[model samples]
Target: MLIQTLAAAATTAAPQNKFGFVEALQAGGFIAYATVSILGIMSFGSFYILFTKFFEQQKIMRQGRDVGTSFWKAPSLRDGANKMDKNSAWRQLVDDGLAAEDQHGKMTDSMEAHDWLHGSLARSEASINARLAGGLPFLATVGATSPFIGLFGTVVGIYRALIAIGLAGSASIDKVAGPVGEALIMTALGLLVAVPAVLAYNWLQARNKRIAENLNGFSTDILANINSKGAVRPAAIAPAKSAAPAAAAPIKK
Candidate 1:
């Protein structure tokens, strides 16, 4: 009899929703939907920048690796330029250097020629680095502002909750549940948007730094090659396997 009475009372109590995301938004009206839409756009933009920049960075780095293998193997600057993709950043640098070389002949002294070539390559490298850095500011802005945007929603939700209390003349669960849930959801969504943007910004910036360093190194090599009239190239280290085979062959013979 006691168990039956408790079960009947449980069923008699108000039936609450199992999920409230939709309900909470509806309760908050236009403000809730607007906030969500803004966050959605920011999330989408952040991902787009991250992916586009990553692929671009990867392409430049891949080209840099190819330079180590094939670029130096060419006998002359004009020959090396032919071996690279015409559209590539490396190709642009070589072309600029060659152009500067041609024009530098009009200069009276060897120092003037060297300065002209160095400045041309430096300018080309700087332009490439600047291009790579283009979308990073968007990621930074999203990371910094998204949390505040979310806080605005939280503040609005809290205000709504207060209004609900005043209207009902009581702090009832039914009266304030929607607004409180909205507040929590806004906070969580803000964090979700912010963390990824911050991470991507830092990660991509680090990679850009690495790429810049490699570009600088390559620029130095190119400058040396230009000044030396293709006489100077970075010495290639023999692979350990090739050295071991040579050592063994000598002993066997």
Candidate 2:
């Protein structure tokens, strides 16, 4: 009988959770839902850009490695370009350089062949850099604006709390807890959405800078090779030579 009475008393003493996430959202109504939806979209877009750009940068880096091995070893510019992946940025630069070289002869008497070729390759480099930079602005936007977006929800939540207090004639816990919780959720959500976006933006931007540097150096090398008519080539990256085994010791000691 004592155990049964204790169980009943324990059950009756436990308080219900009226100030939880669901309750807060329920109190905030349309404004809370809108904030969550917008944040969700921003988070999704940020991750998508991060993953896609990372893979793209990695592909270019791998292609950069292959340039010294497979590319410069070929007999001519045409042969070297054919050795690279056709869709690679390096291949595009080579094709543009070759095309420019072909057109340099057709320019008017006043235009120098070297200047025209240089200008063509520079334009090609700029275009590739621009293409690599395509989706970065969305990341920047999310990073910069997500906090304010969340703040808007917070402001609305606070306003609701104030209204509830006024209607109830006192600032009691029950009257204010839901809206206050909602406001905090908005602030936290804003931070969560913004941090990852800012991190991704910085990381991808750094990768792009590295790629651009590599592209510039490669472009310069290509121009020199083309101008010197296959006489110039960058150092080739040869595979490591295995150490030969020592001759077996004489059988007799």
Best candidate, TM-score-wise?
A: 2
Q: How does model 2 score by TM-score? A: 0.88
What C-alpha lDDT values do all the predictions have?
Answer: 0.88, 0.90
Instruction: Residues 137-162, candidate 1: write the lDDT tens digits.
Output: 99999999999888888999999999
Instruction: Compose the digit string of candidate 2's lDDT tens values, residues 49-78.
Output: 999999999999999999887888788889
Worst 10 residues of 1 by lDDT: 237-246
lDDT of 1: 0.88
Residue 133, candidate 2: alpha-carbon lDDT: 94
Clashing pairs in 1: none
TM-score of 1: 0.85
